[model samples]
Target: MRIVATNPDQTQAVGKKLAALLQPGDLILLAGDLGAGKTTFTKGLALGLGIKRNIKSPTFTLIREYKEGRLPLYHMDVYRLEDGGAEDLGLEEYFNGDGVSVVEWASFIPEELPAEYLEIRLNKDETDDNKRYIDFNAQGKHYEKLVAKLAE
Candidate 1:
């Protein structure tokens, strides 16, 4: 599914909607360029999950955990692992554990990803700095349904 966000708020609204449909063990892969509002989207997710804490990018720390929400949130940024070594992080545990996992720059650790997951790509419009095209690509039946509900 393709979602057009005219501004940051709209993009974050999309994230809130998706967060409502998330279940334990859900894996969401976010692929986008810098300044694409990935972190902004996640802030909305945190709010939807009942997390009141600040939601920041995990770029430097690699992973940030928020357990105050209805479901724990494991936000990860593996961009720093571009050269390899993601295996040491035990990413599968988070992907398979209770609570949802949202991965940024997931392509860096393709081998660590589960077979079934949701991939979201944020493409910025060249002509409009604030516009973003959020593309959803489901990798499994469950994700397909999730995307359908999100579109609704």
Candidate 2:
């Protein structure tokens, strides 16, 4: 599904909506350029899940875990592992853990990903810095329904 967000708030709203339908072990892959609102969307998801802590990008730390939410949020930024290092992170532990996993720059660790996932790609509008084009691509039936329900 393709969604156009005229502003960051709208983009976050979409993420918040998706969060309501999430289940444990859900995998979310966020793809986009720098400052494309990936983290912003995540903040919304966290909020929807009743998490009150401040959400930040895990660019350097790799993975930031937030367990205060309805379900734990395993937020990861694998961009730094573009060359190698995924094996050292033991990413499988988080993917299989009892939480909702959101991976930024997931392409860097494609080999480490599960067979199924929801990949959301964000593209910044050329004319509007705050505008983004969000595309949701589901790799399994579970995610397909999640996306359908999110649109509602």
Question: All candidates' lDDT scores?
Answer: 0.94, 0.92
Tens digits of lDDT, candidate 1, 12-71: 899888999999999999999999889988988888898999999999999999999989
lDDT of 2: 0.92
Among all windows of ten consecutive residues in candidate 2, which has the lowest summed lDDT? 11-20
Residue 123 accuracy (lDDT) in model 2: 93
Model 2 C-alpha lDDT per residue in residues 40-147, reported as the tens digit of each score = 999988988878999999999999999998999999999999999999998999888899999999999989999999999999999999899999999999999888
Candidate 2, which segments miss by more than 4 Å at Cα? none
Best by TM-score: 1
